[model samples]
Target: MKLHGYFRSSAAYRVRIALNLKGVPYEHATVHLLKGEHRTEAWRARHPQGRVPALETDEGAFLIQSPAILEWIEERWPRPPLLPEDALERARVRAVCAIVACDIHPLNNLATLGWLKERLGADQAAVDAWYAHWITEGFAAIERLLAPGPYAFGETPGMADLHIVPQVFNARRFSVPLEAFPRIRAVDEACAAHPAFAAAAPENQPDAA
Candidate 1:
């Protein structure tokens, strides 16, 4: 399996964490998003949407979108489960994941930020504010939903942890004040200590600037 991704991409970062936690060995294909590599013809042929973290599965299948890829990872390797066994618990965990995946990340990803500056004629300060606002709002909700533990959903580093840790990494990059979200901070800190999450960090990736 080969995972095509960029070091600083939050979407790719989540997938890397999941693969590592499952102890799945795979190759990494660096997509330099900053250099517009994802927009090139080659990348477009490989991924129609031209997004990072496009996983070439062991069966020669290509997977896109972090959420679907995450679900596939959990299903393929069920040992160290990334989700809870109970149906109710699984729904709860999925909701927390959506808070980051659906609500927060889409608003603050590289494309949207670039659009704010280039297309909309917004300055750096305005872009920074845009990033911080969504992060703060979404984090407040996540902080409330999080379990009181080392990880997002109790002691294990599951699906929720995979999504939370990467988004927090992005938040810190934007200098978003996290003092208001202690539970989210605690989860970030705890996941940092875990080998899987630590290895999957953006800076730890080979393509990191």
Candidate 2:
């Protein structure tokens, strides 16, 4: 498998963690978002949306979107399962993933931030405030939703942890105060110590600047 991703992309980071946790070997192809590589025709051919994470499977299937790609990985390789065997527990884990992927991440992604500045004429302060506001609000709900644990859902790292760890990394990068979200912080710390998550970190990526 080959993964086309940017080093700092949170969406890409989530997929990387999932692949690593599942013990799947994949080749990395860097798509430098900051350099506008994702916008080129070459990338558009892989993903119509020109997103950073477009995974080409060993069988030659192309997959896009982090959530969809992760689900595919889980289905294809279920050894170190990323979801619970119970239906309700699986739903709970997916809910937490949605909170980060759907509610929070979309708002603060580079495209959205760029739109706020270029299209709406928002200043740097306004953009930064927008980023923090969404993170704070979304994380508040996530903090309450999370069960007390070293990981988000339970003793083992699951889908929720994959999503949460990357968002926490992004949160700290923006200097968003995490004092109110102790549960999130704990999960992040636990994930950092896990070899799979550690290897998938942005700083550890081959394309990291």
lDDT of each: 0.91, 0.93
Tens digit of per-residue lDDT, candidate 1, span 1-209:
99999989999999999999999988899999989999999999988887787999989999999999999998999979999999998998999999999999999988888999999999999999999999999999989998778889897989999999989999998899999998999999999999998898988888778
Least lDDT summed over 10 consecutive residues: which range in candidate 2?
43-52
For residues 61-166, what per-residue lDDT tens digits would candidate 2 score against the true structure? Answer: 9999999999999999998999999999899888989999999999999889999999999999999999999999999999999986989988999899999999
Q: Model 2 clash pairs? A: none
Runs in model 2 with CA error above 4 Å?
none
Worst 10 residues of 1 by lDDT: 200-209
Error of 1 at 77 (Å): 0.6
* lDDT score of residue 166 within candidate 2: 91
In candidate 2, how many Å is residue 34 off? 0.2
Candidate 2, residue 133: Cα displacement in angstroms equals 0.6
